[model samples]
Target chain A: MTIKENIFENLRLELRRGCLTLAVLAQLRQEHYGYTLRKALAERGLEIDESTLYPLLRRLEAQGLLSSEWREEDKRNKRFYRLSGDGEGIFVQLLKEWRAINASIDNIL
Target chain B: MDLLDRYLQAVKKHLPWQRQDDIIAELKANLEAQLEDKEAALGHPLTAAEAEDWLKQLGHPIQVAARYQPQRSMIGPALFPFYLYVLKVAFLWATVIWTIVAVVQIAAQTPSELTVLAAVLRVPGMLMTTAAWVTLIFAIIEFVAARCPGKFPMLAPPAAHWTPGDLPPLGQQLSGGRKPRSFAHALTEVIFGFLFLVWWLLVPRHPYLLIGPGVLYWHASPFQLAPFSVLFYWWVVGVNVVQLAWRSADLIRGSWPRPRTAQTIVVSAIGLIPLGLLLSVPDHAYVLLRNPALDQARYSAALTSINLSIQWSAVILCAISVLELLWGIGRLSLDRYRKHAAAMR
Candidate 1:
């Protein structure tokens, strides 16, 4: 690839990183297991791989932003996740900040 | 099902030990769900080749497992800068001291080519040992800092508690092109200076410590310090003791304030006295203890060569000390002038 293409790819990944976190947190408000949550995000135009999505779920749960429990679904044990009370409050604050940033960027553009 | 199990096992092999079972179970469920969805769309189960391709797309097992594990290093980001600083300072001092010792060895005894080669060959091993020990120390600090953060409060980041008021004043900030002494630099100096002080004190009894290990083959000891060198030894020890104390205090305080900078300049200036005395020692008259293994003529020649070497070493040391003193004074003066100008403004 050309240097410009490589540079653009890096910058794009950088831009997507925060958005990916926000998307994951926003989607985890309702209970969903890793595979379903990944499909839901992909359907909404954020096509995250299992490698990225599953680790992200684990990390969010570790941070206490999401809670999880394993339950039998379709005769197989699946870890279901949803946002916690603290996560809800933090999500609201983050959304507010994100929106403010979006407006500033829109105006600049 | 077999392929999926194998894939999970591959990932499990690379995962953190305590979390391996938990992570693999979760991963297996996700992979199976994805496979079922794909099979449903295709109206048939995936073949082994198809399963292999799918797993390959997800990533290498190690790479996938790595994403699940928290990123880690022997020395974490918080301590890495200090680790690098310690290494740089150590290697710098080692190089300087090694060069001085090599020069002294060549001039003093004029050892055989094989002896010189043997000493030179030891350099890499010595450097590697130094680096390994420094890394091990930093790794231990990193481990303790991670395991018990509250007990190691110095390593704890003040991200949440800090305010804009905690920042240095506009012109006083390090970013404003005014370089100052660093805490790591001061700490390194104190540690290395103390080590040198101990080695210097031991050198009288263990003269071979200054000379290379090749001297062990000699039937009797072949060198002695000139009488003046014996007197100048105390001066060296006194100067080093003062330096070690000052640098230790600087390390503890974590900043080089004006008064401490002034103290360093004074200490450095005083250090020049010993170097001057070292330079004035008589050349040929400075004799070494006669080695029974060598003839009288060889002994006399070696003594003359050794004394001349000592004088030259003194000259080099004196030059370095003079430059260091001048630099310290100039830096102190510049800092004072800047502070005065800032006050006037």
Candidate 2:
């Protein structure tokens, strides 16, 4: 890649990094398995790679921000996820912070 | 289904053993789900090439598995800056000390080419040993820090006490006080300084390097450097040690900071002291013992010519040293004035 494109890719990744976490947390408010959650987000135009999404779900569950359980779905065992009580609280605060940032950026622009 | 199983098995290899089965099961479900969805859209089973293409888009299995593993570093980001700083300072000091020792050895006696080569070869081994020790120490620090975060004040973040006032002054940032030396300039100095050091060490064993074909004439005749000039040779080597060390440090640091620029003036001034002593050795005193191995008159004539050249060379060197000192002082003064002006602004 050209240097400019490489720089843009790096910056784009950085910009998306925090937002990706917020989006995942927001999406996990209702129960959804890994594959369905990814598909749900992709259908809404936020296309995350399966590799990135699966690991992130585990990390969030580990951090007590999300809860998970293995259940048979459509004749296959799939790990389902949803925001925990702590996750719900955190997600609400994060959504507030996100909206504040968006409003500030809009004002600045 | 076979291709999908192979991919999940490949990913399973790279995952942590405890989580391998659990992670692979989930991943397998996800991939099969994706394949099913793709088949549903096309209303047909995927061919082998179609399956391969889908797996390729997901990336290599190792890459896919790697994301599942926790990120690890020998020296994590928190301690990395200190680790690097320690290594640089340690290497710089080591290089400086080594150069000093090498100069002293050469001054004491001219070493053979093989001996010089052996000494040169030892340097890489010394640097590697130093690096290994430094890295091991930092790795231990990283281990400790990982287990007990904020235990070491050095590694702890200054979050609680930090304020806007801790920021650097606007003027200092804008002016960029004492700009770093260019890599090109430092590299050139290092290359030439190293070459000069090698040449200087070689000169004693092979006088021909200095005087060229004139060494043959001097050898055939009986004129050699006077006793004082012989001592002066060692003195010159000693003075050059300081220059070599300073330049080497500058090359390593990629900057001539205030202390180094000050050392430059001091070194140049010290250099002139020897040249003054050299000038005091009397004009005819540069060459001693004129034995007539060839033609007596011709040898004497050549001796007188060589002696005059030596005297003139000393004078020229003395002038150059003085100019170097003056230039250093001027540059230092200008740097200070610029800094002062920037601060005031």
Candidate 2 residue-pair clash tally: 0
What TM-score quantifies how close candidate 1 is to the native fold?
0.61
TM-scores of chain B alone in all candidate structures, in the order given: 0.48, 0.67
User: lDDT tens string, model 2, B275-306?
Assistant: 98889986656886555555566667767787
List runs of model 1 lying over 4 Å from the truth.
A1-3, B99-110, B156-345
Q: Per-residue CA lDDT of candidate 1, range A2-107, in tens?
A: 9999999999989888888899899998899999999999999999988888998899889889999999999999999999998898889989989999999999
Lowest summed lDDT across 10 adjacent residues in model 1 chain B is found at B169-178
lDDT of 2 by residue, A1-109 (tens): 9999999999999989789999999988889998999999998899999989999998888889999999998999999999999999999998999999999999999
**Residue B238 lDDT, candidate 1, scale 0-100:** 73
lDDT of all predictions, in order shown? 0.77, 0.81
